[model samples]
Target: MEKRRAALRLLPVLLGLALAPAAAPACEPALNGTRVESSRFVLSYQSTPIEVGKHFALDIAACSKPGAPEPESLKVDAQMPEHRHGMNYAAKVTKTGPQRWRAEGLLFHMPGRWELSFELRAGGTSDVMRNSLVVASAPVRFTEEEKRSILSHGPWPPKLVPDPSNRVSGNPEAIAFGERLFFEPRLSGTGSVLCATCHVPYRGFHDGRARGFGLEDVDRNTQSVVDARFNRWFGWDGANDSLWAQSIRPLLDPREMRSNATTVSRFIRNNPPFRTGYERAFGKKPPEDDEEVLVDVGKALAAFQETLVSGRTAFDDYRDALESNDVREMQKYPEDAKRGLKIFVGKGNCGLCHFGPRFTNGEFADTGIAFFARKGVVDPGRQGGIKKLRSSGLTLLGRFNDDPAQATALATLYVEAQHRNFGEFRVPTLRNVARTAPYMHDGSLATLRDVVRHYSELDEERLHGDGEKILKPLHLSEDEVSDLVAFLESLSAR
Candidate 1:
């Protein structure tokens, strides 16, 4: 028991802790920036700013006094008390020479505060020293309800699932074929216009125009396809229920691809690679009827687009941390973002519609924005969408549906236009929203701040629904507005 007391280890209060230091042993070395001296051992280490979610190495030099016994071994490890968890991976310590050592495979998964400890043991005696590191991560703070609200937004980078309605949903062959067609301008009547011509990859898969320009200017803003698969309805007006049908609309719309079924089928049947890919994807030659051929092509395109989920963002990490009760990891999220998220979930009332993993309810809402397409033409919102859906032959309810039960048919079976839907548009997903800017259905909000401001100063009279009590002026201060915008930006993919 006396011998056990001699080997007793002491740890200094890390960061802001105020623990009493243990009486050090006789082997203390001169102190330096890279070196820490204790009574039983001297340890030195070198490292730069530690990065989160990545493995890193620490080169260490440790020694006992000249007359002292050599240590039997060294143990290295790390943990965060606030998070109530240790490193997801264990680091290996190796002796290089007389007193030189290296620790490898050290990683900080969630960033905030961490403690790295090194223990030197010899003949049942040990000495320990701890280094505090604040790994770089986006800092955030939250209230209890805010935590609950954020958690609802994810487990993110949502899983990709096959569309039951589209027979070629998850086929890699179909995805590759669709990818090729996406960049193929030849599918269009005008040779210069390709799907890629508007939905540029670098531009976050949005056309980057106020109104989409195809053969002629279209009335609505180009919605980005980053996580389109998760949506219940497609397009700004919620015109299409299935992504495949949604893809078909643009190909046939004169304002968009401006090509008929004959033109697209000709292109597919004439091109050897496309024809071969069509067969591989569909298990048959291209259909003779232009409409049948169009359906297959749309399915291929939807398969590829489903793979476009936004990468996990800072909000995802922070939300996860909060859910796991990791205080240290939660601290890494920016305070500004935290405040903004609070406003969004609470005072701002944005969550009424922008709720769920994709940050949208996948339903339509009237935000009271002006809907004028030009001088006198009105862009009738969901009402127009319903009329179009009912009148069109390209819907999930049509004979083109390969779905045996027509699983995507329920919404179609029940959907009907109402007077309240006159000015309502689909509630757009907010994932990667920072990159898809010029907000709202008309691209009327030039900036996200403008969108926030619009809600802050909304005109109740302009709202078409008399019973719609949700839209009211927020009267947010300038700082609150800034905070809200900051939170919204945290949703962008890193």
Candidate 2:
């Protein structure tokens, strides 16, 4: 009995030790010896552990040294450690009092863990404080009506509408000859620049520049050669109606290829390899006439450009897996990316503008980019394209085109309807968006996060001048924003 009582007494002592609190780790001092009065900052949201397709907010404040001037700017930023994605925070600041400021803003998109940092700056001094938060995923809810509407009707490998009179389809010899002409610098007037110089093979068949510089500065973004055959209209302004017609524009442009019909014809006639290739493709010797020779050159260049297609990406694989209900393949994708995909196709509403296999609908909208400033200095876009199409001699209506009849009709129709195409620009494919930074028509935004933030908090006032409505704010959480970016990166083939 006495031994049993002693054992019971020992059990209480052991339990007490197990329940004791752990010793706190020693706190490290700041580098500049600026003591932080209160390291804690509050970030409250509409929901805790935010879900996909939901909205949330972060509220932050930090206490600093006594008599410290208000921070010049109280900035907050976020990072997703798991996905290695982040964004610079854009918050509305409210002065709570001296040395205390509060920041509040929305986070839109999907669920994930996010690290938020507050940059408190006063006078010349600055300090950063950080905290972590978790956002949980939610169940997907789709309606039968919505599901039916999402079904894609467009044909895969997109239908190629070939001209019956041209007889150019599946002509291997013509394609091979065209490839040679495309890379040859001799096609240009200066002989210093080749077609490949502007239409690069690796970089989405486009040189990464806002405007191309050739014999002189050309004021227009370099259009991608990939999927040129799929386009109903060509160029940023949709100026050209046919591939053959579009090819001749750059050759004759004083600032671009700068080669007239006479110069181009003389060079091709003298080049033995080019002459042989042309004879094989056309079933005749190189054309003697300057106009005929220039037409043939344009045809050859178009043939080569039609072949640049994007390789399959992770998103394609995931999408196929989802459609097939292949749970095994679906599970293989990065979990965060999968969550991001749900947000992209659901709450983000990016699919409204960027849709289909190519991630573009081939339509135009005022994305609120600052293309035109003053009345005189305007980037007229489609307005200028309509004028150029009607006035230029190199258009499809000209005798130099391969299929003049069909090309001319299409060009005429566009010219007649020019008023409807104002302020419009072709929506570019987003296959390799991650590699090509500085998004939009003008290449203004520096990163994908910046682009998202722009759309997240877009103001209608900024878009007033363009006569277009601004994109509404998304109000996504920090974690959800990171997931959306993660999903976008998965679209890159690399």
Highest lDDT scorer = 1
Number of clashing residue pairs in every model? 10, 6
TM-score of every candidate relative to the true structure: 0.71, 0.68
lDDT of 2 by residue, 171-268 (tens): 77778888898888888889877787888877766777766777876656677777676665688776777776688788888789888898888887
lDDT of each: 0.83, 0.65
Tens digit of per-residue lDDT, candidate 1, span 178-293: 99989998889887688877788999998778888988988888998878888888888888888888887888888888887888899999999999999999999987798899
lDDT of 2 at 359: 71
Candidate 1: residue 192 Cα off by (Å): 1.7
Residue 459, model 1, lDDT: 88
User: For model 2, what is the error of residue 198's alpha carbon versus the real structure, in angstroms, after optimal superposition?
Assistant: 1.9
